[model samples]
Structures are given as structure tokens and as C-alpha cells.
Target: MHDQPWTTAPLVAFDLEGSGSQDHEHEAILEVGVVPLVDGHPDIRNAYDSTVNPGRRIQRRPWSSPGLTNDVLGLAPRLDAIEPELAGRLNGTSIVGHNVNVDWRLLSPRCPGIRPASLIDTLKLARLIHRKAQPRTLTALLAYYELDDEVTELSGGQPHRALWDAVGAGLLLGALIRELPHGGSLTVTGLHTVAGVSLGDAEQTLPLF
Candidate 1:
């Protein structure tokens, strides 16, 4: 292990964009993206993204985003088809992402057996590190940390597509981790010490991460 909270832990930045915000609601998962990082940086070529069949008719109403459509998802696998693979990659890894709770809520149930021991949120990390910064979107943080060049080019073609966003998130975290004042005080026990809670706890000790 690398000694940090996520040391020796394979990292996967995952994202899920959906038609609606319900775990078991009528809406569907529009897209899912995953970028696995080893030793802090994205492997790039190994990224995964998929549009899924919701098993029901996709809403093609005016309120829907153009990107969320049956046409986009027509060729993609159903949610059930991809669940096994997603669960396998996610097992025992430290998951990092921007607004990761959304992703977890939508997909975690499909992988009921896997319990991530650690999680790092770039969104929370950004607020913690740059509380005084003027702007704080993921893109802004990328620029602030001089990481825009590394990731901006990757997501350019797909933009908001789930997988590309996941990769961008991985890049963002990689940049933030490297830019930390001293690589951050990131030991597993140390994090538990300061967080005042264990990773296996069902709920967070504090409302915020």
C-alpha cells in the first residue's frame, strides 16, 4: 500500500447521467462512464462509457436534453448487461469523482456486493483546498491547477458524455492530488482519525465530506 488513505488502491472515477434523479423511479440511466486510475493518473486508453437501455420507452419530450434519447442509447447495452463488468472494476477501489454521490446512488444498487472502503470527492476537495477561490466548477478548478491542458483536449469531442466526464474528473483529481500542499495527509487511519468515522460506516459522521 502507498500509505495514504487510498494507497495502493486502484482508483476509478465514475459518472452517471440520468433522465431523472430517482433510484427506482420511472426514469432511466442516460449514460455511465468510468475512468480507472492507477498511481494517480488516468490510464486513458482503458476508459469505459456506455449508454444504457432503461428497459422502458425513453422520454422524448421537450424537457429532455438532446443527448438523452433512444437514438443515443439504441446501440448500447441494457443496464443489466453492463452491471457485472462495472461491479468487477469497482470492487475494493477508492472511487474519486465530482459530485460522486449522484453516480453512486444510481449504480451502487446494481453492485450490491461491493463496498468501497474509501472515497475522495474532487468537488469537496476543491472546496476544502480553495475556499477562497473565486470560481469553482470542475473546469475552473482544472484551469486553476493548470490541468486544463491535460484533460480539456480529451473531452473536447464528447463534452458532457458520461465517460468523458469521468475521465475529466480523474484528471481533475490527479491534478488536485499532485498540487496538494504536501500530497495531503492521506493515510487510512489518519483520515479515520480526522473524519472521526470509519469508511465502512453506513452514514457519514458529518453531513458534508
Candidate 2:
């Protein structure tokens, strides 16, 4: 098990905009954004964003509110085309995001060989820290921290874009880490334990690649 303190480790917070909620075999990833962190701080200069063609037309659903339309994706590269670059970014870094399981489900099958060193779900982190904070969505968490305006500025006043959400998720992770009660330092394994059995089996430390 990698036992590095999360505060000092290199991490990557990412977000995905997919065609739908359920991870059906046919469902496709529409957009992906990655923000790399050094010592728990976002390295915005190296952030990455890409639009992926799911090999099929995106079906619009009430629950799905993707910023990219099928027409936009028509000109984008396929998943296989960018898997090499994406894999390079994810490998050897601890992964962080809000409701990250959805992103993992959409990404792992596409990139069979990439495995993150660890994983942190900000949505789960928030629940563990502040259970009474109503509407624990990313938007709500940003608002809770008075960061909604800052996110708007970061994304050129846009929300739901993968890059924007990735940046926001990274910022939220930093804030949550700061909020941790002082004592022994926060480690990747410790955070995973707090995430509990409902997340997955305790022994499965590495994320689904």
C-alpha cells in the first residue's frame, strides 16, 4: 500500500461529462477534464480537457445536461485516439473528484492499462466531514465554501464544463484537506477507510483502471 500523506503527494482531480448517468456498455464519455496537483495544490498551467466521440450519437435525456452537443462531438477525437495521453496523466497519481465513481466507470474500460495510485471522492469526503450540509453536489459545496463566484471566474462564468468542474473539484479537495482536524496527518489510506465499505471492498485500495 502506498502510504504517502495526501497533503504532500501528487494528485489529479478530474471530472467527466458523459452521455448518460447509467454506465451501460453503450454509454459514452462526452468530455473529460483533468487538473494535476502538486503537494495538494492545482497546477492549472498543466490542466487538460478533451472532447471524446462516443462512437455513437449522444441521446439527450432529462437527467443528462451535457455542455457539448452531438454536433460538437462530431468533430472530436475518439476515446482510443486520446487514451495514450489520458493514461499518461492518470498513471502514478492519486485521483480526486466529486462523485468520482461515475467518472471511473466511464473511463476504466476505455483505458485498460492505466491505474491511479489512490482515489479520493470529494462528495464522500464532504459527507464524512459535514453531513448536515444540504445538497452535497459540487455546486452546493462550492457555494458552501463561498467559492461559486471564484469557479465562475475560473471557468469564464461557465459551469458543467469538464475542465471547469475539474478545477472546482481540485479546489474543494484542498479546502476539505485544510478542514481536517489537526493530529496525525491525513493519508490516502486513511481517507479511503473513512469512505467505508459502501464505496467498495476495503482491501481494494487501487482504483479500477
Candidate 3:
């Protein structure tokens, strides 16, 4: 799995909208989205997205989860109801997201037995590709690459939503993969030096081939 290039190995880009909490322990997932990548393109046809009822009121924050009211969230499935589907799509797949570990920290505990074969952090990739780029957030990075419109069209939803961010991360990944400094084709393992799961590991970029 480590040696497989993203162009060949399967990748599942995912995002989890949480209960507006910074601490993973307190962050209940409000929604989830996953889009598989094929040939460097997001296959939205097979995409999975749903609002998961947190079983409690989601604290309101400015722009946290726009238009998702308690009434709306209450009607959605609980995490346990969707656990199998989430694990089916995520486990053993190469996972991609802007700050992926954050999602993992929140997701892994709730969905036991869920794990990924590899992780790619587009936030780290953006810094490596464009050192002087400003505001490396997912929204900013998509705009930086001029991919915002396409991702928006593909997602058909606004930012901060799981599906929209999933599609954005999938597209952002394809763009970043093309701009990698490595010569010729690159493998999933090759991106680890700059886009490893943790911030500390991603900071150490020694030659690895």
C-alpha cells in the first residue's frame, strides 16, 4: 500500500462536521462525507454524505454549520446507524483531507475498528508546493489553485459541510499531487515526507524515495 502511487491505489477523501468543539473528546460528529478518487478525479457518483444526529443540541457558532438546525439534525441518523457504511468506505483506503488527523481523532473513537491504510494532509502539501502562499486553509488552498469553482460545482453545497469539504480535499489532492517537487511519478509513500499524518512528521522533509 505504501508503494502504490495515488494514481493507481484507491483513495477516499473524507470530512466530518463536528459539534463545534475543538476538543476531540467532546466533539460529536454532526455529519460525515466521503468521496472516492479514481484516476485523480473525485467519483461523486459513489459519494456518501449524511447528517448524523449527535443526540444532543449542536452548539451554534458563527458559520460552524450554516442552516443545519437542531430540528434538521435531529431527523438524521445517529453515528451507530451509519458506522458500517463509514467503515466500509474508509477502512483500508488511502485517506485524504486538508487536516486529516483532526477528522481521524474525532472519527476513530466513535467508529471503533475504522482505520486507513495511509493519510495525506493537503494542508501540509499546500505549504510544500507554494511556500509563500497565504491562508493555507482548505477554502484558501482551493482558491489558490483556482479549483474552487469546479469543486463547488461538484459538491453543490457550501463550505464547512462534510460533502463539500470532501470533494474539495479530493480535488485539492489531485492538484497538489501534480505540483510535487519529486521527479516523474510519485507514490503515496513519497508524499509522507511532506504530508504525513501528524504536523511534526510533516515538518521533517528529508529525501526519501
Best by TM-score: 3
Task: Please state every model's RMSD to the true fold in angstroms.
Answer: 4.4, 4.2, 5.5
lDDT of 3 by residue, 1-209 (tens): 66876567678889988875553356688889999999878999999999989888877878577767899899999999999898899888878888887777667767876767778788878887777847688998888789889988999998889999999999998888788666247876676666767523333332121
In terms of lDDT, model 1 sits at 0.64
**lDDT values, one for every candidate:** 0.64, 0.74, 0.80
User: What's the lDDT of the predicted structure labeled candidate 3?
Assistant: 0.80
Question: Which one is best on lDDT?
Answer: 3
TM-score of each: 0.77, 0.84, 0.88
Runs in model 2 deviating more than 4 A are: 1-5, 183-209
Which of the two, 1 or 3, has more lDDT? Answer: 3
TM-score of 1: 0.77
Off by over 4 Å in 3: 1-4, 22-24, 198-209
The regions of model 1 sitting more than 4 angstroms off are 2-7, 22-24, 60-66, 184-209
Give the range where candidate 2 is weakest over 10 consecutive residues by summed lDDT.
Answer: 196-205
Local accuracy of candidate 1 as per-residue lDDT tens digits, 164-198: 66777888775655556655656544322322222
| Clashes per candidate (backbone, < 3 Å) | 1, 0, 0
